[model samples]
Target chain A: MTSSVTASLPRPSPFHLLLAFGSGGLLTLMVDFNGLVGLYATPFYSSWVAHGTGIVAALAFLALLRLRPEAGAGGAKPAAPLWAYLGGVSGALTVILTSTAVNSPLALSGTLALGLAGQVVFSLAADRWGLLGMPVRIPLLRDFAALALIAAGSVIIIFGRGA
Target chain B: MIEAILIATLAGVLVSLSRQINGRLAVSTTPLVASFWNHVVGFAVLTAIGLVIGALWPAGAFSAPWYAYLGGTIGVIFVASGSWLIARIGAINTAMLVIGGQMVFGVALDLVRGAEGHVLASALGVALIIAGAALTQRRR
Candidate 1:
C-alpha cells in the first residue's frame, strides 16, 4: 500500500516567538561586545571592516540561499513592490547614520529607541504599500504590550549597569 | 538611564515595523535584499554625515588596527545570517537562538578579557531578556 503525504499550513507558535526574542537579545549583546572590541582596538578599522564584511557575508548568504532553497521554508512571498526594498535599505542606513551623528553608542538606550521608530515607520509603509513580505494583521493591543516588554528589557541591559 | 530608554524605544519601533513589513513581504527576499541594502545605504549615509561633520576622515580613520576591521566583517556576517534565520524560523525563534549563542560567546570572551563584572551582568541580563521574550511568544 502507498502512503499519502499532506503539507499542513504553517501556524504561529508561541515557542517560536519566545525563541525569536531570546535570540534577538543574545544577538544584540553579541553585537555590543563586538562594538566594544572595536572601540578599544581602532574605531575606523571597525567601520571599514564591518562594511567589507557585510558585502562578503551578504554574497555568501545569497549563495547559500541559492544552494539551499529549503532555508526559506516558512517565509511568505513578497506582497509589496520592489520599492519597499529600497525603503528598508534607506531606513537601515538612516538608523546607522543617526546613531553615529549623535555620538551615541550603539548600545545606548536612546539609539535603540530611534532605531525602533525607524523600523516602525518602514513597516507601516510596507504594510500600506504591500511592500516586503510583511503579513497583514490587525495589530491588536497585545502586540504593543509585547513590544513594550521587549523595549524595556533592551533598555535595561544597554543603559543599566548590566552592559 | 535616559540613553537606555531611547535605545529601547527605538528598538521597539523597529521590531513593530519589522512585523508590519514582514506581513507585507512574508517572503524571504525582502529581508535578504534589505540586509544587503542596509550596508550600502549605511555606508553612504555615514560617509555623508562624516563629511558634513568634518569627522569623515578622522585621524584614526585609516590608522585603526587591522583587527578592528576584521571584527566588523564578522558582525556583518552575523547580521545577515541572523536575518535569514529570522525569515526561516520566525523572528522570535531566530532572535532567541542568536541571543543565546551570543551570550555564550560574549561571556566567554569577556571573561578572557578580565571583565568579570560585565560578564556577570551580561549573564543576568540575558536571562531576563529571554524570559521577557518568552512571555511574548504566540500561544498555540
Candidate 2:
C-alpha cells in the first residue's frame, strides 16, 4: 500500500499558488511577532507562548467551524496513527537547534542559507519516497528549475541584506 | 563550525519533517485539527523544558505589546495552510512556493519599515523568485 505509484495530480491551480504564497507571508509575520517576544522573554517562552495562543485560536476556529458545516465535508477519514501527532516534537526541536546555530559563527545568514538547503533536500526526498504517509510524485524538469530559481533567489536575499 | 552547520541543516530538515507529520494528521483529520494538535502538543513539551531548565517565567515575560503575542493566531492559519497545500501540490512545490513568498514578502516588509539595504540585490532576488513562480504556473 505504501509503495503504490499514484499519478501526479493536476497542476496546482492559481488559487493554491496564491494561498501558498500568502501562507509564507503569514510566516514572515509570525517570525516577526515571535522574534519580538523572544527579545523580552526566553526563546522557549516565545515558542511556548505561540503554541499556547495557537491552542486558543485553533479552539476558537474549530468552534466557529462547527457552527457552519463545510460543504462536501466528505465521508469519515481513516484515523491518524499516534505518531502522526508527533509533528510538534519535531517543531520544538527545530527551535532549540536553530537558536543554537544562530549564536554560532554561522550567525543568521549562514543559518538561513544552510537551512534553506536542508529544506530543499528533505522536501525532494519526501516527495520521492512518499515519506511520512504523503503521496509520491515524480518530479518533473520544471520542478528542478523552480527549485533552483527559488533557492538562488532566497540565497541572494539572505546575503544581500548584509550589503 | 561543523557541528553548527550540521545543526542548522538539521533544523531545516525538521521544518519539513514537522510539516510532513502535520500534513499526515491533516489528511486523517482536518488541517485545522492537525494544527491544533501541533500547537498544543508543542506547548506541553516546551512547558516541560522550560520548567526543567527554570526558564518558564523569564524577566518581563508579559511585557510585550499585545500585538506581539499574536504570532500563534497567525501560526494556526499558516500551519493549516501548509498541511492543506502539501497534499495537493506535493512537498517540493509547497516548499518552493512558500519560500519564494517568504523571501519576496520579507523584502517588501523591510522596505515598508524603512529598513536599510541595497535595493538592487533585493530587486534581482525578487525577480528570480517571481520567474520561478511563473514556471510552476505554466501547464505543459
Candidate 3:
C-alpha cells in the first residue's frame, strides 16, 4: 500500500536498484506503447480520452492504496518550487505528441528511437546546466562515450527493425 | 518521417522535464499526492485543449480496448518510481538505467509479437545501451 514494501527496507542493494530503475523504464514504455496502439485503433478515442481514462485508473489505484492504513510511510521532503507542480502539463504534452508521432509513418521503434535521442540530450543538458533545479554534474570523457554508445544502440534498434 | 521525428523529439524533452519536476515534487510531497497533481493538471490541460477545439470526446470512444486506457495508470507508477529513484541515483544515472531497461523491454515485446524486425541489430543496440548504462555508473 505504501507505494512499495521496498520503501521500508534498508537501502537497496545494487541488484535492487537495477531492478527498480529498469522496471520503471519498462513500465513507462509499455504504457506509451499501449496508449499509442489504443489511440490508433479507435478513431473516436482521442489521445485526450485515452490519457484521461488512464488518469482515472491511477486515481482509483491510489484510492485503493489509501484504504489500506498501513501504506503511508513516505515522508515528504522539503518543499519544492511551484514549477515542480507543473510536471503534469508537460506529461500531457508528452502523451499527445508521442501518440500523434507514433500514429504517423515513423512507427513505434522509430519514434521511440528519436525520443530516446532527445531524452539523452535533454538529460545530459539537465545534468550539465542544472536545469530544472537538478544538480549540476561535470560529465566525464567516459560519460560522453557512454552517451555516444547509447545513441548508436538506439539507432541500430530503430533502423534494424527493417520496417 | 521528419515530422514524426520532430514530434517524438519534442515529446521526449517534455517527458524528461516532467520527470524532473515530478521528482522534485515527490521530495516535498508523498509520491501519491505528487502523482495525483500531475494527472489532475495534465487532465485539465488536455480538457482545455479539447474545449478550444470544441470536442472533448470523439464518437465511438467506448470501442477502444481496455488496455489502451492503462497508460495513465502506468504513467502514475513511472512518475512515482522515477521520482524515488532519481533522488537516490541522480538524474543521469537514473535516466540511463531507465533507457536501458525500456529498450530491452521493447525488444522483448517485438520478439514476442513476432514483428519482422531485425533481431541482430536490436540485440546489438540493447547491448550498447546496457554498456553505456554501466559505464555511466558513478565510480565510487
RMSD for each of the candidates: 7.7, 3.4, 6.5
Q: Once model 3 is optimally superposed onto the true structure by TM-score, how far is the C-alpha of residue B34 displaced, in angstroms?
A: 1.9
Instruction: List DockQ for all candidates.
Output: 0.29, 0.74, 0.51
Q: Among these predicted structures, which one has the highest TM-score?
A: 2
Task: Estimate, for each residue in A1-163, the C-alpha lDDT of model 3 and write its tens digit.
Answer: 3424323222334664586556656575656555565555532234566456656766687777773212433455465677887988997788678778878888777678778777877877876676776656656666677668867876787678746
CAPRI grade, predicted model 3: medium
lDDT of 2 at A2: 30
lDDT for each candidate structure? 0.46, 0.88, 0.69
Alpha-carbon error at A21 in model 2, in Å? 0.6
TM-score of chain A of each: 0.54, 0.88, 0.64
Best by lDDT: 2
**Lowest lDDT block of 10, candidate 3 chain A:** A3-12
Expressed as tens digits, the lDDT of each residue in A1-163 for candidate 2 is 1323324634577888899999999999998899899988877789889999999998899888882213213568777889988999898888888889999999988998999988999999999899989988877777789889989999999899865
What's the TM-score of each model vs. the native?
0.57, 0.94, 0.80
Q: Write one digit per residue (lDDT tens) for candidate 1, span A1-163.
A: 1112111112235655544434444454535644654465434334534654666666677676673322433545524455433434433443444445346444444564455454545443443343445332333344445445554544444444334
Q: Lowest lDDT 10-mer window, candidate 2 chain B? A: B131-140
Q: Give the CA lDDT, 0 to 100, for residue A114 in model 2.
A: 93
